[model samples]
Target: MKTRIVRVLVTDDHPIVLDGVTLALQNTPWLQVAGYARSGREAITAVERLKPDVVLLDLRLPDMLGPEVVQALRAQDSAVKIILFTAYPDHAALDAALAAGAHGAVVKDTERDDLVDAIRRVMAGERVLCINAAGSSGAALSRKLREHGLTRREYDILRRVAMGETNPEIAVALGLTRNTVKTYLQRTLEKLGARNRVEALSRASQLGIL
Candidate 1:
């Protein structure tokens, strides 16, 4: 008997990641790339129109978070299984994705064979969590970030900084003094193991702070 081809819709804000995954799945015998999308809205539209059997989604999207997208897809009452495919992996993110109705979780670096296995498992009504996630802390900056004891306001400032805001601009926007903004940014960097704004933002984004 011929094996069934599992139709999949892949979503990611980064075009390169989306194309890479789609191409990887193209040769899988039991899987078919139903379609691919670049953002949360496009992913939703594709799901509505194509109704693929499974959806591979990115956690941090331009318009919506991965959990938000998962919830939205579930709200549509579609039986299409969702797998959170992200570059950053941790226990917290995976838990959130699962809570939002994702059937599995995989990172960007997942081996093609492992990715194929994840999709196959999800199609068979199993919840799949990639190997990397098993030992990951899942929280932003891993738990050590929290150990530094940064405040929520500090994280907020760092998030804005990640979006490319300057100290003066952040101060103006947050109604704080320039000194205060500078102080917060420095503290955030120190706590997150960053030497500068770029490194801070990169590390924080990896930990899902952004």
Candidate 2:
């Protein structure tokens, strides 16, 4: 039987890293390097134009963070799988990216075999997360979100709140009405058992949900 090919669009700012990843995937029988992108916007555009099966995305891009890019991609194409490829040293950032909707993550220094395995695993309907050795469990963030009954939108609003964005500002940024933003905020406060935004933020921070 012939192995199925998984076309992947790689997004990274570094030309050298892009070339290296393309070369590595080129040697893999079941994988195809569909295209390349140098920034978050470019990645989004490439995915729309190429409609690749998978996206090997960098955690940090010039125009947006990994999580933002992941969210954008997911919004555009729910069927396309995404794997965050990063050398970023922060575990929290990785968790955030995963929570935003990535199928998996592979550290940049991982061997080609490992990277290929991760992609295959994701294609097989499994979530793969192989980051730095010191990183915590890949599902930790998502687990917490589930346990808290926090929806992604609520979490996003909470994050904006943490960044000191008010309801009107969040509404503008998220394209929601002011009333809707207020309702989401009120629900979030109730979930966190806080009387106000400040207390809610404190509780979320203590729980490491921020």
> Model 2 segments beyond 4 Å from truth?
89-91, 134-210
Instruction: Candidate 1: list runs displaced more than 4 Å.
Output: 138-210
Looking at candidate 1, the ten consecutive residues that score lowest on lDDT are: 136-145
For residues 60-158, could you state the per-residue lDDT of candidate 1 as single tens digits?
877755555787887765698998887767533455556558888888898999999999888888988885756464454446347556676786676
Residue range 1-210, candidate 2, lDDT tens digits: 887889999999999999999888998888999999999889888989999999999877766656668888998789999998878534345667777789998889999999999999999999987877435644565677788988878988887775556889999999999999999999999999999987887787667575
Candidate 2: residue pairs that collide: none
* Span of 10 residues, lowest total lDDT, candidate 2: 133-142
Q: What's the residue-level lDDT of 75 in candidate 2?
A: 80
lDDT of 2: 0.83
- The candidate scoring highest on lDDT is 2
For candidate 2, the per-residue lDDT at 37 reads: 95
